[model samples]
Target: MTPAARHAAAIGILDRWLAGEAAEKALTNWARTNRYAGSGDRAAIRDIVFQSIRCRRSFAHLSGAETGRGLILGALRAAQTDPATVFTGDRFAPAPLTDAEFATETALPPAPSGNVALDCPDWLRPLLDRALGDQALAVLEALRHRAPVFLRVNSLRATVDQAVAALQAEGIDTRPAPLSPRALEVTGNARRVQTSAAFAAGLVELQDAASQAVVDLLPLTAGARVLDLCAGGGGKSLAMAARMSLQIFAHDIDAGRLSDLPARAGRAGAPLHLLDDAEGPERMAPFDLVLADAPCSGSGSWRRAPEAKWRLTAERLTQLCAIQDSILTRAAALVAPGGVLAYATCSLLEDENSDRIAAFLDRHPDWRCDLSRQFTPLDGADGFFAAILRRVD
Candidate 1:
């Protein structure tokens, strides 16, 4: 498809997304219906859709409207591209800009600062400010762009150097991420990772560098019994297994999320025992370490899931906090005497990170937090928080 055709397609998908359909769903539906759109076309369209969403507020401001056309036009202007190039009303291109649109696009003033400029929702601004202070705007600004792809060298199968060599052989260039020794930030040809020989042989797995850093910080030991309390997809569980010889068990409240973990573990050659909703937590009590990668507003990962920031509500955040509290309480009970409970979230909000740790300590005097750390995009990774709490007699 022509570049103009791709933009037109992105406009339609963005319109469906604006109408309340999920961006991914709209893209999938569009792809399925337009079977003739090649892989390149689909990828190009998807990039346009996600980029538009990532900078939605600023785009809206630039175009003076929140519609799909406005966002695409704004995107083009942001790239310093001529709107007339794609909005040419040529075959398979978006309709020509109206005189009013032309005026808006040409005479567009600089976007207002703060929330809109950062693409941060108004209600979330105070929360971010309180949590990040001077870095709030920088963090939000980072979210307005795409996140880099990171891979964790599965040490159980390959050394970091070995993984790098194998990936390089496949035309995927990577450089070590300073956040974690095992992390490789994919520099080029990231789209071919899944098909690369290294990935098929379990030499590397798609994981964020911050996530690898979090796992690296956990209190792990060889032959220890570990429980991943909320091990959705078991990314951390596999990472743990690769880090040391651990008898790791995975469980999630929603069993469906664990359905693919077994195959993933098999591929990585990381042995992981699975627990179903009816079975784990109580029956498998007294684990040496329990990791609750709790669910949150996902604010730290807005770069990857931009719509989540726009969709988050105060009520929903409150509910999530309550659920996090409940998970802490229940997971604590499953900890062995003197074992550790690792609480983590992909959120930059204090209400979800340190505040939750404080509340847990206040309620449980017998336990003490050993370490707490927050990772932000400034650290070359997504925002992540992890705290280690140890039980004492």
Candidate 2:
């Protein structure tokens, strides 16, 4: 498809998304219906749609409207391209810009201010500022662009050099990410990774560099018993398994999330046990380390899941904080006397990160936090917070 047609397609998908359909679902539905759209066309259209979402408010301000057409027009303007080129009224192309749209070209308002310019929700601005301090604006700006694709080399299977060579042979170029020794930021052909021998052989797995860094901080010992308390997809469990010879058990409130973990563990040659409520993870309790990678607003990952930023509400955030607190309290019980209870989230908000940890410490005065670290986009990784608390009594 021509570039113009791709923009037109993106406009349609964005409209569906604005109308309450999920971005991924809308894109998938479009793809299924438009079977003629090639892989390249689909990818290009997806990029356009996501980028527009990331900078939605600023784009709306620029185009003088909040509709899908306005967004595309704003995108073209941002890229210094004329909208007339894409909206040519040609077959399969977007219709010519309306008179009002033409007027918008000259009557664009002064740049958006404060939260709108930052593309951050107004209610979230204060929380973000509290969490990020002086770095808030910079981090918010970073979320307006695409995130880099990172791969974690399975050290148990292959050396970093071996993984790089294998991926390079398959046309996927990568370089070491400074955030973690095991991380490799993909430079090209990232889409081919799933089909590459390196991935099939479990030489590497797609994971955020900062997430890998969080796992790196775990104090793992040979034969240590580790419990991933909220092991959604078991990413941390698998990472820990690959790093050391440990008896790893993963448990989640919802067992369905672990459905693919067994296969993933097998591929990576990691020894992981899946525990359900019926089996009781507490039955194998007193774990040396328990990791609670709880859910959150996902503000740190807005660049990848831009729609989530717009979808979040104040009530939802409060509910998540309550859930995080409950998970911390319950998971702490499974930790042995003197074991480490690690809390982690992919959120940049202080209420979700530091504040949650403070609340946990307040409730359990016996546990003392030994270490805490926050990773942000400014550090070239997703915003993440990890704190290691050791039981003293």
Prediction 1 global C-alpha lDDT: 0.92
Candidate 2 C-alpha error for residue 186, in Å: 0.6
lDDT per residue for candidate 1 within 1-393, as digits (tens), equals 999999999999999999999999999999999999998889889999999999999888888889999899888888889999999999999999999998876678686577888888898899999999999878888999999999999998989999999999999999999999999999999989998999999999999999999999998989999999999888999999998899999998888999988888988999999988677678988899999999899988989999898889999999999999999999899999889999999999999999999999999999999999999988988999999999776
Go through the candidates in order and give each one's C-alpha lDDT: 0.92, 0.93
Model 1 bad stretches (over 4 Å): none
Candidate 2 overall lDDT versus native: 0.93
Note the clash tally of each candidate.
Answer: 0, 0
Give every collision pair in model 2. none
Candidate 1, 33: how far from true, in Å?
Answer: 0.8
Worst 10 residues of 2 by lDDT: 104-113
Model 1 lowest lDDT segment of ten: 105-114
